[model samples]
Target: MYDAVEALEGRQFDVVYTGKGALCYLPDFAQWADVVHQLLKPGGSLYIVEFHPLLNAMGSVALPGDTDDLIIRNDYLEGRGAIAHDTTVTYTGDQIPGRQRSFEWMHSLGEVVTTLAATGFQITRLRESEVLQWPRFNGMHQTPKGWWRLPDEAPRIPLLYALLATKSD
Candidate 1:
């Protein structure tokens, strides 16, 4: 990873895009922001389309005997440190034969925007959507566009969010 960073040194990119379920693995926003800032050219942009922090905090695990209900099962903010999980099942209906452990950190929207701002990026756009790429919950339905969404009667929530930030010349 350090070698990749070094190879890109002094390089400028017109745009950088990061997708869903990526940010949770990053432990330090400041370090990430520094790398992004270094990669962008003057007036270049960074676009992040990711799962909303609220959705991450709520998690995709169905409540016991209540797969229809969404619950806050994790931290919504950063101060609590990393969360560790041990599982033998994968999200794609595959079962792992051996134990697996993973660690993740929750980052609020405020933290994202602030980190970019501190790194000298100007926030251009921010959008939140109720659409998801898969059925995160038991009763979600897929739309014509292939995205999943909560049923009409379910309370609306932001499942995904996108932000655009530009490095000024």
Candidate 2:
């Protein structure tokens, strides 16, 4: 529920961050762009560090059910509607007990970049690093340089990522 384009008529803010909260749940990119543009002040910066949407498209074999505690996926690729489940996520930090699950959309890395560029925000610095703060992937371990890429025996896939950019003056 946002009239982003209309709000741009006369208003501004120092920063417009759209990563951690419900914004990331946006089902439409064009609309999300509006919110980012209107909420940003002149020369202000926009930093979005979100979970890799591509990772969201994965089809897992995690156990299934509410009390059973397992996988929770909603066919976002089809977009019929969210087929939510009850399962708790076990992250490195905040490994809260219990089980609860929900549906999520998939946005490729390119999609994320293109969406921002289309919004008038210049790509300042794009860095792809392993999970730094709290890794959700079981295959992510820290290293001297930073979060190590190698999770198990061989390092092949990346855990999570971040994006940093600023609005052009």
The per-prediction CA RMSD against the true structure, in angstroms, equals 2.1, 6.1
List, residue by residue over 11-70, the lDDT tens digit for candidate 2. 777776655434345667557765776677868777777655434543335655423211
Clashes of 2: 5
TM-score of each: 0.90, 0.61
Q: How does residue 8 of candidate 2 score in lDDT? A: 67
Q: Which stretches of candidate 1 lie over 4 Å from their true place?
A: 1-4, 59-67, 91-93
Question: Model 1 misses residue 37 by how many Å?
Answer: 0.4
Model 2 regions lying over 4 Å from their true place:
1-10, 21-24, 58-101, 139-152
